[model samples]
Target chain A: MARAGLNAERLTRAGADLADELGFDQVTLSALASRFEVRVASLYSHVRGSADLRARIALFALAELADRAADALAGRSGKDALAALANVYRDYARTHPGRYAATQLRLDPETAAASAGPRHAQLTRAILRGYDLTGTDQTHAVRLLGSVFHGYVSLELGGGFDHSAPDTEETWSRILDALDSLLRNWPD
Target chain B: MARAGLNAERLTRAGADLADELGFDQVTLSALASRFEVRVASLYSHVRGSADLRARIALFALAELADRAADALAGRSGKDALAALANVYRDYARTHPGRYAATQLRLDPETAAASAGPRHAQLTRAILRGYDLTGTDQTHAVRLLGSVFHGYVSLELGGGFDHSAPDTEETWSRILDALDSLLRNWPD
Candidate 1:
């Protein structure tokens, strides 16, 4: 029988928490069921399988991140918006490492299309307006900013910058400053 | 009997090739042995195991990529250096997909310390001289550039930008331009 007070939403939230604790790879139907004091078959009722659970967590993370970005960017522009957007991603990665990792997993085109990922892109594009870019240049800038932000956060999270050379936090701020400067004087 | 003219180097190279064709995760000892017309047991004599073989391939890729970056950046500075370095990575990812992906896999500290990854950081720092950044800011810019290039390329390779946008090539150029602009006009 399905466990009392156990539902898909509760299971998905627990799965996300477990993801932050163990990692995305370690999150499984069995684990979630155990956490809820239920059986594996019971989890199958809420989640199709392990993949479905992971995908749901990914969607949750993308939405949460987009929401934070939207909130951060509100009433902000120019460098303010840029830093806000960048920080939202970096913070999310740090706070929810497992969920952040899931965001990198490849999804089917249709699933990706339906994901909250587009909202992240839109928020970034909105921030670019402060720089006066239009058309293809703006699009290009948005793509670049997304790349650098995601790339930097991914590497940093992976401990790529664990060296003794100036702490990463110091470097992150400087990079934000440089990004602002670049947008102000984009090359011809 | 071992296949005529079969050896570890050949096996590693073969594995690397298979990686390019199938992806890093798909490369396996049984598959490599099967492809080489040898039993899996016989293949064990040449390499420690699947993990060992992958590690060697990762080192091979790091050295090879560092060499390419060195050649590309030879006597180049600023935008030229940035573009060439970035291109080496992108081109390598495109041409040697498996090996490139392996480069992202976690390496043992000893192996990583011996790897040519240091050369990459040095090259990036070299490009920074053309910009006005110094001390912590320079360090930050280095990290930022690494994040963007890697993040953008990984996402693109994973088909993150395959639809609903301009061509990836255009985006790549725009990113390099943005990086150069950002670096040249670094914030105070």
Candidate 2:
């Protein structure tokens, strides 16, 4: 019998909330079972197990993040678009750290292709369209941008910049400025 | 009484090796006890528990990485120093994935001050001396470089660049080139 209030979608949202609270690593099936006041076996009907639950959360977070990126990209280009996209990630990570971490989960090839991963790449490409890069140069710039954003956000969230001077915000803007300068004058 | 042939250093080394085999999360006091063929209680004599063991591993990894970075940076400047420092992290992470992950563990303020973390920052600053950055600009550059290197290595390690076109090596060199170009022409 299907539970009136419990389904994969509902469970995923709850699990995501739990992840934000306890962290992505702590959002286990047993923990969710406890939260829902349901048996672990019952959850198996809605989702396969722990891995499946995490995968669902990952997919959910990816879609949500991609949507935000798309919204941020509308009618923006160059450094404006870059800052918009970058801030979306930094803001999402700060506000929903667990969900942010979940987006980093490595999905299998088939699942990854079906997820918002491609949209993320496309959105990044859109920002690059403002630059003069093309072909492999564009791909390289995409990877570089991905690295800086991911690295900076992960470090900031992990307290890597908590003790540093000059403030993270200053560094963030300067880094963006530097990226804009680099993109405009990309070397051979 | 201390156990013969067993000490904190030895246990930490064994734990780091086990982390490489099973991942950092899987390295626990009980697991180390099993590896040592002793009881967990006996293991506690050497280290407080799981947290202490992990902290020690983090410090050890940080020191090892700093040492390698310092060595790679010898007799190099400008882009050479940058690439050398970047390559040390990438090679160390590829060879010692577990230990590399350990270096990222968030340490308490006091512990962080005492760890090789400061040296890692100093080494980064040393690279910045090759450019025109100073004061906050230098700090911003430091944070930016840290983010790119950390972000790129992490994504690569997590297979983010796998299944993508142009191969990671090409992207890596191009990123270094772009970074070199950016540092040379940082915006005002």
Candidate 3:
């Protein structure tokens, strides 16, 4: 029988907490076992190993992010929807850096297809409904937005904007404004 | 006496090559020592340890990237300059994933200030000269471009765009177009 308080979900959540505290790279099975006061062999019953634990954490992060994004996009539209969705990612990264990092883990195709990855892509597409894009233009815009949101947040988190004047929050709002303008008047 | 054929510069360069072959996280003093077929202790003369070695590699990558950005930005302006600069990052990341990852490493403020990091900022500012941005708008635009460039390259490298339709090249060029239009329009 499984341990009274330990299951795959429970262990995965603990691993994520460990990641948030010590960083995703540090959330190994052994470290998790130590945290749970169990032997590494005990974790093997719940998680295959380090990679499996990491993947589960990654999937968990993706699902959590998708849930937040869905909620943020609930009633918003146009630039409102755009900003809301963008904030979902940036805010998630800020509150949960380690889990955010896990979301970037490159999953195998089969696993990724089954994960919340598609929900993310779909949410991005829904944001485009507010703009005047179509055909390949929609696809292009989606990629552009993904790049900007991911790029800006990671750079900010990495201290890329620390030494610069005009704080990041101001820049972020302006970026959203600029993106809105770009989408409204996308080039031919 | 020091080893006849080994030195700090050579070790750093070899470490970078190892990064390109393996991932950046895998580059360590012990690993570099194995690559050089020398005792790990022998490397203490060149580097403090794994962190020091990684920092050196990061500095090397920042300088190399700055050099390439400068080369790409020369004799170009407006969209021409923008495309050239953008391509520099994408091409570099594609050709040298590990070294590219090193460029993202967070260094101490003093080390970052002395490194070629500032040159990257200056080159980015030069590209903005082609546009009408002034004051913090320039800074915001700079941040935006950095975010987009870094974000897009990392996502593409991570296969975020692999499962999508419309080849990344098409989306890339369109993104450039959208950025150019946004910069030229400069929402009020």
lDDT of candidate 3 at residue B43, scale 0 to 100: 92
With a 3 Å backbone cut-off (N, CA, C), the pairs that clash in candidate 2 are none
- In model 3, pairs of residues that clash are none
Docking class for model 2 is high
Number of colliding residue pairs in each model: 3, 0, 0
Score candidate 1 by DockQ. 0.73
Candidate 3 lands at a TM-score of: 0.97
**Model 1 - which docking category?**
medium
Q: What is the lDDT, from 0 to 100, of the residue B20 in candidate 2? A: 83
True contacts kept of each: 0.86, 0.96, 1.00
Number of the candidate with higher TM-score, 1 or 3: 3
For B151-181, candidate 1 gives per-residue lDDT tens digits of 8888888777866568888878878887887
DockQ numbers for every candidate? Answer: 0.73, 0.87, 0.93
Give candidate 2's error at residue B27 in angstroms: 1.7
Candidate 3 per-residue lDDT, tens place, A1-188, comes to 45547789999999889988988888888888888888888888887888999999999999999999999999999999999999999999999999998998989988988999889889999999999999999999988999999999899888788887999899999999999999999999
The candidate with the higher lDDT, 1 or 3, is 3
- Order the candidate numbers by DockQ, best to worst: 3, 2, 1
The per-residue C-alpha lDDT of model 1 at residue A147 equals 88
Distance from true location, Cα of B151 in model 3, Å: 0.4
